[model samples]
Target: MSLTVDIQFKRSSKIYHQGPISLINQSVEVTKSGKIPPGQTEIPFELPLSPRSSSKTLYETYHGLYVIVQYSLRCDIKRSLLAKDVSKLQEFIVEYRPSNGETDEKKAVKFEIRPETLQNVRDRARIPQFLVRGHLDSAVFPLSKPLTGELTVCECERGISSIELQLVRVETCGSAEGHTKEASEIQNIQIGEGDVCRGMAIPVYMVFPRLFTCATTIAPNFKIEFELSIVIIFDNDHLVVETFPIKLTRN
Candidate 1:
C-alpha cells in the first residue's frame, strides 16, 4: 500500500451537481512522486506550493449560491491495481480582516438580547436565572478600532467566571443539490475572569486584523457574516453562550 498527498486552491461547483465544473487555480504536489510504501513513510516529506501567474490567491474564502472558492488538501491511498483505492478531502479557510489602525470614523452599534431571544437555548418550561447582554460602541468599525462594548450578567448564583468575545465570518455555498458551510475566526479574546458576584458588568475591548477582511456582504453563492459571541462560564460547569450578529462595514 502507498499514499500520495496534494493541496489545491480552486474555484469549484458544489458537490452532487451533474457535470460539475472546477478550475484548479493552483496546485502543489509532494516532490516525492512515487507510490512510496506505507512502511517507508517514516521519513519526513515537504511539498512546494505555487500559484499560476493568472491565478489569484484568495482574498476571502467565498461560498456562493452556486460555487465556492475552496482550499483543500487531498490524500490518496493506493493498493494492488485490482484493489480499490481510497481518498480523503479536507477543506480549509483563508481570512483577510485587519486590525484597527487609524481611522476617524466612529459609530455606535447596540444589540439587545431579550429573554425571548434566548429561547433556543433556554428551556421554555423553566425560567432562566441569568441573562447575558452587551452592545458594541460602534456598529461599523475599521480593523484598527477596538470593538468596545459593555457586558452585563444578571446572575442568581454568584457571577459568571469568564467572558469571551469573538469576531467570526460565516460562509455558506450550494445550490439545488446540497450545501457546504464554513465559519472562520476573525478575532477572539477572552475577557478574563472577574469577581464572581451578581450584577457583574464588564467592559469589553478587542481588535481584529484588516489584512484580507472585507465589509459584510451577501451573494447567491455565499454570504459573509460578522458576529460577536459572548460566553458565560460558571463555577458549576454550566455554560451560557450568546451571539450578536453585526455589520462590519466602515462608517
Candidate 2:
C-alpha cells in the first residue's frame, strides 16, 4: 500500500523592532525510514514575515521578535497484525537564511538563554504564522517489517538579534484503539539565552514508529488506524503544529 506524510510550519505572532521583517527561512527532511532513503526528501524555502499591525509590542525591546513552528507527518501500512512494535527515528536538521544579500550557506550564531531571561520576554517573543509541507513513501516494506521515520527543525538564527526556544509539545491519534492517548514526552534541556548565536540553526528531532499494538483480539482482515501531531512554541509567541495520519491494512 501507498502512504503520504504532510508537514507544515505556521507562525502565529511577531514583534519586530529596530529592524526590517523580510522572510522566514525553513527546511524539512526524512532522516530515517525502514525501507526508504533516509535523507532523500527535502523542502527549503522562505515565508513572508507579514505581521498584523495589532500584534506588535511598544516596549524598548532588546530582542523584539517571536515565532512558532508546527509540524506533522503521516504514513500507511500495507499489512495488519494482532501485535506490533515500533522504534523511534533519529535526528534531522533545519536551518534559516537571511534575505539581506547573505549567502544561503552562512553559518548560524549560537546563544543559550537562562530560564529567567526567557521568562522576561516570553510574552513578547510570540510566533504568529510559520508553516511548511512535505511527504514520505513506504512502498518497499515487507509484511514482516513496518515503516518508520523521523523529522527535525535545525537551529534558526536572526542575525545579531537572538531567538529563544520556549516550549515543545507533541500529540497523536488514529483508527487504532487508544492510539490517541499515546504520549511520549522529551525532557527539555534548557539552553541559556543568546547561546544560539546569529546565522546558526537549532536542531529538534522527532522519531516516528511504524507499528501499532492491537488493543484486543481481532480478525486478520481488519484494519489498524493511526494519527500524529507535533507542536512547537517559541519565545516570540510563534507556534508550529502539524498532524499526520497512517493506516495498516490486512495483507
Candidate 3:
C-alpha cells in the first residue's frame, strides 16, 4: 500500500490561456507489507508535505477563472496480475495560518452611487436619474467573517427590478514575456427586488466561499485579487453598476 500527494497549479486551456501543469507530484509508502482479512479495516499513517524544488512554496487551494490551485491524496493497493489494482482519490484544502503581523483595525468606507458616478456606462442618455448612498463596514475583510453593509435608494425616477451584490475574482498569470489578467464573477446575491421602498435601508451581506477564495495572494509567478460590484437593474432592463476593490486577509 502507498499514499500519493499531488498539488497542481494550472491555467485552463479552454477558458483561459495555458495548458495544465503539475507543480507537485510525490508519493510515500504507507506500509511495506499489509493484509486485509476482514470486511472493514482502518490503517493509520502520516506524511510530511513540502514542495519538490527548493525555491517552490505551497500555495493555498484556490479555484479561479484562469488559474487553479488544488491538492489531493490518493491511496493505491496493488494486487495480483489477474486482480486489478484498487485506488481512491480525494481532494483536500490547504490554508495558511494567520500571520502575527496582521492588524485588527477595521476601516469603514462610505460612498454614493449616482448616475453620474457610474463608470462603465456607454450612454448617459439612457440612464435614469438615481441616487444610492451606502457605506461598507470595512475596506478590509477577514476571510472567516461575512461582508456586511447597508444601502438606501434616496431617489429614482424609474422603478427598480433588482439590486445585487457580486463578488469577482481577478487572477493574473505571469510569464517571462508578459502577464495576462482575467476577471470573473465568483458569486452574486440579490439584496433587494421588485422596486424596494425609497429611503429605506437595505442590508448587504455575503459569505466568502472556502474553496473559491483565499487571502488576497501576490506571488512571484501569479497574483490573486478580489472585488465587489453593486448592480442596480431597473424595471426597463437598464442597469448601473458600482465597483469597489476589497482586501482579504486571514485573521
lDDT of each: 0.55, 0.28, 0.82
Candidate 1, 47-92: lDDT as tens digits: 3334444433333444433334455566665557797987777765
- How does candidate 2 score on lDDT? 0.28
Ranking by lDDT: 3, 1, 2
C-alpha TM-scores of all predictions: 0.52, 0.23, 0.89
Candidate 3 Cα outliers beyond 4 Å, as residue runs: 1-23, 53-56
CA displacement after TM-score superposition, residue 106 of candidate 2 (Å): 36
Worst 10 residues of 2 by lDDT: 58-67
RMSD, every candidate, angstroms: 9.4, 23.7, 2.4
lDDT of each residue in 1-251, candidate 3, tens digit only? 23333333345433434544455666777766557777987778876667667427777888776777777788888877798998998877889888789576898889999977778678888789999999999988999899999999999999999999999998888755477777889999999989999999999899999989999989777889999999999998989989999989897
On the 0 to 100 scale, the lDDT of residue 101 in model 3 is 93
Q: Give the TM-score of candidate 3.
A: 0.89
